[model samples]
Target chain A: MDRNIARLRNRLDGLGVSLRPHLKTAKSVEVARCVMNSPEGPAMVSTLKEAEQFAAAGVRDIIYAVGITPAKLARVAQLLEGGVDLAVILDTVEQARAVAEVSRQTGVRIPALIEIDCDGHRSGVRPTNQVQLVEIGQALAAGAELRGVLTHAGDSYRGGGAEALQHCAEVERLAVVDAARILQHAGLPCPVVSVGSTPTAHHATDLMGVTEVRAGVFVFFDLVMAGIGVCQVDDIALSVLATVIGHQREKGWIVTDGGWMALSRDRGTSKQTVDQGYGLVCDVNGTPYPDIIVADANQEHGILAARAGSNARLPDLAVGDRVRLLPNHACATAAQHGSYNVVRGSSHVVEAHWTRFGGW
Target chain B: MDRNIARLRNRLDGLGVSLRPHLKTAKSVEVARCVMNSPEGPAMVSTLKEAEQFAAAGVRDIIYAVGITPAKLARVAQLLEGGVDLAVILDTVEQARAVAEVSRQTGVRIPALIEIDCDGHRSGVRPTNQVQLVEIGQALAAGAELRGVLTHAGDSYRGGGAEALQHCAEVERLAVVDAARILQHAGLPCPVVSVGSTPTAHHATDLMGVTEVRAGVFVFFDLVMAGIGVCQVDDIALSVLATVIGHQREKGWIVTDGGWMALSRDRGTSKQTVDQGYGLVCDVNGTPYPDIIVADANQEHGILAARAGSNARLPDLAVGDRVRLLPNHACATAAQHGSYNVVRGSSHVVEAHWTRFGGW
Candidate 1:
């Protein structure tokens, strides 16, 4: 995790862009501190629950990346009044009006950002929707600050190779920058131009017009990231420690206690070249057990089987063998547990325990 | 939830079988209390944490349905010593011997059940493995009590219609009963014979040879159950309430705030006749929105799109329109949230908030 943080920080530093690491993956105060070690500290949060947690941990600046709804504005106002520089993102005029009304009613200054659609993946307005962007900007009434624009190339996860990632990152950067330019030309304050996705942030060649880059999963790279050519399987930092409870000898299956409940149901690597079923099984020391993969899972049991065509002699695993599992997606897997049992040394000794919060 | 509980209880009463409702669905004391309202107040738990929770809630007779691991035996012993009649399941002699060792060392009698494989879906020894079953039964040493057998026809989730479900229920019944008969023939005390799956329990014509039936996901029936011909869509008790935040008008998509994080990524209905993508979209009143389905989902955004051939005009969904989503799998979806904002009557008035626990 420390190495991953350093790699991203050093890369962003060289590119003259601030790293606003998304805490949605870790959701821990200690992790946020490590990621935001720079002089200008800020972070991106996906939910209001995350903003509350980071705010309590003394993170002054937080961008709630989800598009805001009126029902949740009072909670945002409460956070704003509590001395946190919390900003929200929106793409529609109705949302902008709601934010303005909430701020006006509460007498709290709410910082806002226009979410620009980069790769047509999830939420955000198209960069070319100048009229709608200007209208949304104009709708930011009293006690509201039109901060800038942000975009996430969420579709970057679909393709493979560094070239595809680079192209996606460029699209993300240009879209947000163009949106910021449009807002600025319309006499709106466009200071922070943010863009990211773990894949894009890792492979982008340049960030000329972007001021801040946000990425989450790189801190604990998973099978999906490795499948996309971002990092190798060895680079995955997070894994679930489980115990082999039984075996289906005839079927050549080793049953483990780590099911979908422990490993998560995120099959992010299903579309990749090597479709890792649930996860790749490994030894306690984090060494990959070749050919063994969690082929199927129940609520509390995982069936570990050898990959097809790899009919090499299977290990003689007993009833109480302990094994580790590498996840398909770091964000989903991390959210399954309340805390992480950190192991710092080569001996796989229990070091410090870090707690993470979830749910909204 | 109360209605669903009553319906199941009445059905099981007529069949003369004890219903040991699996509390894995709604891991709440309140829901458990409602489910255990009958004279036979015992409940089945998936995790030790649940056993602890139910024990604290005064549920004396509890069964930890998952296979036992030696590492968790001490905790089981602790619960046993606390006056809870906690029984655990295992299919291997190694596990049985470990349990026997722990029981002998701690001097706290641990009741054990042999998990019989009725279907080739997950854990358990096949019913035909009589020698192995007898060996496992005999492996129970000084402080261990062999308490019969249990089986879950987990593959009942596959294919639709009442005929398939009835066949699955019969298989589950006969397999567990046959395992018990073998154990009894070997001079082992085979008192209880348990078998079930939500679909099987609902469609089973007879439970004559079975002492108890264990079924989860029936309390909050989902699309999977509906697809399997066990329950209708209206029988689904749990639904995620979300707000329509944006739209891709040209693509006929209504973007919602309820994403895979909120609605879960369990695509259990993908193999069904009707492939409801992420979930079936409904209005706030719990009425199904005609031809609308969650076509795609991100971490925190659900794309509500019209079905392929359905050219019906979608109702104008404003930015703040609230909608409800019926999940693909109740167990997986319900695990995503900490609590359920329960509503009663057709008016959908939220009468109470019931908390549900998660994590192993």
Candidate 2:
């Protein structure tokens, strides 16, 4: 985790942009402290629960990155009144109006960013849709602070190799930069220009107009990121420990207690060149078993088998033998458990237990 | 939940078999009390955590339905010593030996059921494999109590309509009964016979030699169950409440705060005749919108869109408007949440909060 944090931190520092590590993946204050620029962070979060939790942990500069709803404004106000510089993101005039109204009503100037669509992957206004972008910025400037513009290169996960990732990073940069430029030309405060996704954050060759980069999953890379060439399989920092409970020897199946409930249902690698099934199987010492994967999963049973057409012999895993399964998507899989049984390096010895929280 | 519970209970009662409702779905004690045959429970659980929690809540007759491992026997022994009749299931002689060892060590005659594979879906010994079946039973009877046999029609989820489900039910019953006969022929005691799957439990025409039925998801029917003709969409008792936060009008997308984090990534209905995307979107009153579904999901954002090729108009839902999303798999979706906001049919008011526990 420290190596991953350092890799991104070094890259962004060289690009002259600050890092606002997204805390949604590792919802642990201990982990947050390691990745943040300081103990009191300028971090990003997907849910208000994260924002509130981090705020209590002394993270003052936090942005709730998911699109905001009017009903949630009260909670945002409470955070702001508590002296946290909590900001929100929105793409619609309706949402901007709601933020402004809440800011006025609470007598707390709520800071917000206009979410820009980088590649039409998910939410946000298109960079070329200047009218709506300016309207939203103007509405926020009326009462709330129009702090900046933000965009995520969510489509970057679809492609592999450095060239494709660099292109995605460029598109991400241009989208938020263009929106920030438009807001500036319209005499609106667009002080912060943010963009990222784990792939883009690692592969970007430039961040000239961006003020900060945001990413979460890099803290614990998984098979999806490895599939997209952002990291190697060995670079993945998270895995679910499972015990062999039974076997279907004729069918080459070694069943384990780790199932979809333990490893999430995120088949993020199904479309990749190599599908890792539910996850890649590994020895307890964190060494991958060649071509072995969780072929299928029930609620509490994972069927481990050799990958199709692979001659990889099924390891002689007996009942009570322990194995680790690397997750397809770290964020989704990590959300399944309450705490991380942290182990340093490849040691099997006990280490500190880091608690992770979940909820909207 | 009450109505769905009663539906399954009445069906099982007519078949003269007891209902040992699986508590893995609703991990809430309140919901378990509603679904169990009695407060003391003849219930089935997928994880040891559920067995321990329910046992702490006074559920004595519990079965850990997942195949047992030697490492987990200590906990089973602990439960047994605590006066809870915690039975276990296993298909291998190795597991049987471990159970026997634990029973001998702890001075608790651990009861175990030999798992019989009704269909080649997942775990369990094939009923036709008499040699293996008797071997496992003999191994259990040597030190542990050989209770009977159990089988689940896991493949029933693949087929829709009554005839297919009834066939699955009969196959499940025959598989367990055949295994019990094999044990009896070998002069081994076979007192209990268990068979089920939600569809099989509901559609079984005859329970002939079966002693008990086990089904979990039926307590809160989901879209998958409805698609398979085991229940209707209106009968689904669980949903994720979401707030409309934004829109991409040109794309016909209504964005909500509920994502895979809230709804879960279980696309169980995708293989069915009518694929409900992430979920079926309903109004606050619980009436589903015409052809509307959550088409895509990010970590914390659900994109609500009309079903492909449907001429249904997108409802003008504004920011802060609430909607309920019926899940594709009740067990998977409910596992994502910490508690259920109990409400009466079609009412928006939350009457109580029923906490659900998770972990292995």
DockQ-based CAPRI category assigned to the predicted complex of candidate 2: high
Measured by DockQ, the strongest candidate is: 2
- Give each model a TM-score: 0.97, 0.99
Q: lDDT per residue, candidate 2, B174-284, as tens digits? A: 999999999999999999999989999999999999999999999999999999888999999999999998888888998999999998889888889999999999998
The complex in candidate 1 yields a DockQ of 0.68
TM-score of 1: 0.97
Q: Alpha-carbon error at B288 in model 2, in Å?
A: 1.0
> Candidate 1, clashing residue pairs?
none
Q: Per-candidate DockQ versus the true complex?
A: 0.68, 0.81
lDDT of 2 by residue, A59-147 (tens): 99999999999888999999999999999999999899999998999899999999999998889999899999999999998899999
- Per-residue lDDT tens digits of candidate 1, residues B1-360? 667888888899999988899999889888888888542358999999999988988888989998899999988999989988899999999899999999889988799999999988888989998899999999973459998899999988895578988999999999998998998898889788999788888889988789998888989999988887778899899999889888878777888889988888788888788889899988888899887888898878899988768886676789889998999989889988989887884567778888888877
- Model 1 CA lDDT for position A298: 82
**Residue A197 CA error for candidate 2 (Å)?**
0.7
